[model samples]
Target: MDPWQAGLARELIMRLPAGADSAAAGSVLQPEQLDGWSDLDLHVDLPRSAEPVDLLAGLEIWSVTEEASADRQVLRAVITDGRRVDLVITGGGRVRLPDRAPDNHIRALVAQAAAKLGRGDRLIGLHLTLELVRHCLVQAMLLRDRDQGTTIHRSGSARDALADEIAGLDLDDLGVTPRPNVVERTVDLYARWRSELEPDYRPDWSGLRAVIDRGLAGR
Candidate 1:
């Protein structure tokens, strides 16, 4: 981590209210490998009621967006220095996702995302696309396990696999996934690997494409 970023983190840790527990996650935990592009990921647990947003006061905040709930708050902020911070504050009511089989999960997620695009929900559509790149694609690659001449089981792996999964796609900050058909191209790449990994199962690629078409066409 940059010394300045580290100092900012320490400042955050120090400013937490009494009885609250906080720790660094993601790249912050690995100080030695920290780079200019890395962001600060902080998870905080609050025992008593407190304003979590108060933590960023007086900082060079460029933009901030948050999700608030009875039990949790998620803050995603960008510093004036261009680094991003993901801060999750939650209590005993923390949520968790159920375990899912890899192939089935990917299929479901892709279909849902494409359908979301068709419904003019571009933000969610892009979010799901990146999610697939960061996670589902990695899962599909490792599950294959044959080409490597070694068994693969974990989520982390070579960078080349990830690059291959996201090839030929222009990821945008806003939710406009058009030109060269980003959704179709990404799905095509995934379906190729998925076919080899689970030949018995089939995903509804065309159906979702129709949804995207209708949504983009404003029907």
Candidate 2:
């Protein structure tokens, strides 16, 4: 955890109205604490009568409109405290409130990779690297299908692009490579994602592609 980033997150949390509940923060880097170079993730439990947008009007964060989920109105603003904060406003009933939360499956995988890297476990690290990339690619594919209003299916171009991106990473220098069964493993995961969250709403693939491309480009 960066001390400066942690302080900035705390400052923004304190600025919220007194009644907000289930407000908490997390980071993509550590996944262990609300600390990282990437933007801070903040969730605020909203009251039924509250207007989420209006409440966030004064924040200086960029609005990540494309990434907003149906159940939450999300806004990203760069706070005066010198950190970008992602504020997710959701109804109280939809919020998950917990203390000492366990690492999500994805984060757990990332943490395991980091641990392996620390101990010079090259093979294990490579496996976890593929796991992480596969997870993200599957999520992107699912999101694409949901936006397209179609049954879950694979997009060869999109998957190939993702594979290219993964291959281009400096993982070899870090002592990792794609495992022998990487593709099959990815296929299995994709099938599971399709079964679990079949698209319920029509998605605009063209628009979704633009968003996905921008995200991949780190825009």
Candidate 3:
């Protein structure tokens, strides 16, 4: 339910040549429920009388690859706006929610990232660390939302929840100021996000912090 993707999907359906019955999407993004690391799983149906070529004609696309399928027509595309989309055209269906990375999978990768840093493999370690922060966490958040009945979707939508968690903090809250250092702040943020998941299934926050602290000890 990402507003952007949802709007785009609607625009997509409306623009289709008449007789297009419905559009659908799923997985990853439920903006109200979970707008996190997910993709635009958009699908629409072309009327039996309409040709894909006709539907594609005059539509702006940056690049696309035709996917061969025995049942439906598929096109993997990067639209003009740089949004990657999968155009799945079939008979018709209603537009649905738009799209999990598992917790253990990310935990394992983060562990590798930590180990890499500990071993002086700075480049790979940094790569993993940054990717986890920027991308993987959102996926994990989305999964958590699904598990928790869609109460929290992503970091963007959880401002209220975050505020509640730190309601009466000092003016120089770590979320705002560099309380101790970036590493400690990172640990704190992870601790907050980790709470949304089942304790047993959550990542080892303390373990992660220890690795990072050790990894960055010398420089």
Candidate 4:
């Protein structure tokens, strides 16, 4: 962890309100790999009486908003100190996944990449695109395994397979367009792999293309 992150994490822990079992998560617990841009994640086990929004808002850091999640209340905000914070609040029950985590990751990356493209930041957008492709490949492998009656998480072999498949593709050819040919190809790839697990499933990339186009127009 960066020295500053360690100090800030300690301060955040001390600032936790009473009557709830709260602990630092994410990079806060892994000092060696913590980076400057890493957000501070806090997982809180709270009772019904405690209002999570009020508690986080009381910190006077920034305005907090609740995101729509089918599972539990998710409070998000960026503190004045430039550290993003995500507080996952629960009432003792675990929140089950509405969909696979890899799909959610791709959606988030698409949004972030669109924003970066809007700002005319090609480097970050490309980087995010690369991550999206990698995750898609991993998701494909996971689904493939599930079909064979062997549930397996992402492993090195899966990643290697993805690397081999895309070894000849020119990732740099992707430009700052909402509906880049590469992105369309990626969506097709995702659909092909996902169909192995979900015969009738298809991803909605039109909305993502619109978001990217909007970003480019803003640029």
The prediction achieving the highest lDDT against the true structure is 1
Q: Against the true structure, candidate 1 has what lDDT?
A: 0.59
Give the per-residue lDDT of model 3 (tens digit) for 4-122: 55766676666666666555566425454422222356666654552243444444443455545545667654334334456777763222211112343444345455455445456
lDDT of 1 by residue, 1-219 (tens): 244456767888887766778888886676776544355788888664523236777665544555688778787665444445678888743322222234545545555565555455788888888787766465465665555656755654563565654764665533435533566667676666666667775554543454354445532
Query: How many times do residue backbones clash in model 3?
Result: 7
Ranking by lDDT: 1, 4, 3, 2
Q: Candidate 4 on 85-141: residue-level lDDT in tens?
A: 677877643322222333444544565554554455678867887776886676667
Which stretch of 10 consecutive residues in model 3 shows the poorest summed lDDT?
A: 92-101
Indicate the worst ten consecutive residues by lDDT in candidate 4. Answer: 93-102
lDDT of model 4, residue 178: 35
Q: How would you encode candidate 2's per-residue C-alpha lDDT over 78-138 as one tens digit per residue?
A: 3322344566777642222212112134333443454354345678867876776667566
Q: In terms of TM-score, how similar is model 1 to the real structure?
A: 0.41
lDDT values for all models: 0.59, 0.46, 0.47, 0.55
> Which pairs clash inside model 2?
60-78, 61-76, 61-77, 61-78, 62-76, 147-203, 147-204, 148-203, 149-202, 149-203
Candidate 3 Cα RMSD after full superposition onto the native fold (Å): 17.8
- Candidate 1 runs further than 4 Å off: 50-53, 92-219
Instruction: Please give the clash total of every predicted structure, in order.
Output: 0, 10, 7, 1
TM-scores, all candidates, are 0.41, 0.32, 0.35, 0.44
Give me the runs in candidate 2 sitting further than 4 Å from their true place.
1-103, 152-160, 175-219
Candidate 4 runs further than 4 Å off:
1-102, 143-165
